[model samples]
Target: MYKILIVEDQEKIRNELGELLRRYGYEVVIIEEFENVLEDIKKAEAHLILLDINLPVYDGYYICKEIRQTLDTPIIIVTSRDSDMDELMSMNLGADDFVTKPYNTQILLARISVLLKRAYAGYQEVVQFNNFKINFSKGILINDGQEVELTKNEMKILACLTKDKGCIVSREDLVSYLWDSEWFVDDNTLTVNINRLRKKFESIGVENVIQTKRGQGYFIE
Candidate 1:
């Protein structure tokens, strides 16, 4: 089943859209925090997204661009802003489709169906971020023209951080991922790996990408 993330802030619209999608046999994840909409979508591992333009912390255009940089998750702008500029901005930011608010249910569903097919059929192999192209399949991080090798653990850590790019990744979650991969290690080991990862980033002429969140976790700055 395809996962559909609803990033709309209006309670009624969000719920209604979710219900509509759910009825069509799509699993829906509703957004509860407008301030962290993009993070929520990433964590959900959603197949497609219905994003709103007028959000609390960041607008849809900003979120769209950020997601496009790292992921190719199909985004359909479901917003009340129907101006030409709004539509143009949505397209310019890499949105797959646009649906104006008070949308006709059928048209919305059709657009989503098309985008989902396109997305699942072909997805980006490299996640682009800050002049770096991270290739997970080959365990390589490329910057400019240089290629930096990453160990299995380092690759996993980088994957986790890049997956949650603009948001914090809790230490607990990172540890859990490692455990799930049958590579159990102490917290100290994770720290050492993180430091090494930072050094690799530095070698690539990048800095401050992996940020420590004090008692929380880590995030890409």
Candidate 2:
């Protein structure tokens, strides 16, 4: 099933949308913490998002911009604002579609279904080399049918390497991917994350899953 996230602060709207989407066989998550919208989005791992304009801490535009930096998931602005500028701004901020409030339930569901099918109809979830099962939507990793605890950095590194298995990822690229912004992170931090990932692999009986090239980079073989 495809996962969907609804980022509206109003309890009634959030619950109604979630229930409607769930009835259509979609795994839906409603955003509870408005202050940490981006973090909640990452945790939901949703294929598509229905975001509202007015929020408590930050507006939907800010969240959309932040999400675009790392993820390519579809975002549909579902707001009460029907102004042309509002629609244009959302599109400019990487929103895939826009729907104003008081929308017809059927039409909203149709838009959602079309976007979900277009984005994920044939896409398969990625599987790591060492029998580590990662549910990108839930941000959970499973090893031997049990959940494996991983730091956020570890998950990001593993996702990057496993997504490009057998390809050497340069240190610069790895650092950029992990940091996501122009923040300076020590080289030793990357090394630590890699070591932690190696231990996880070792725990699952997979030796040398991630190979290093002295001055080049690392790759999952």
How much lDDT does each candidate structure score? Answer: 0.77, 0.77
Q: Please write out the lDDT profile of model 1 over residues 108-190, one tens digit for every residue.
A: 89888887665443323578887788875445678889877655457667777887558899888887765443233445767
**Cα error of candidate 1 at position 206, Å:** 31
What lDDT tens digits, residue by residue, belong to model 2 across residues 1-221? 57788899999989988888888888888888777778888767676889998998989899888876656577899999999999999999889899999999999999988886665443235455555676543445677776544444565677778776688998889888867443545667678678877887677556777899989999987
Model 1 spans with C-alpha error above 4 angstroms: 122-221
Q: Relative to the unseen true structure, what is the C-alpha lDDT of residue 58 in candidate 2, on a scale of 0 to 100?
A: 89
Question: What's the residue-level lDDT of 1 in candidate 2?
Answer: 59
Assess candidate 2 and give its lDDT. 0.77
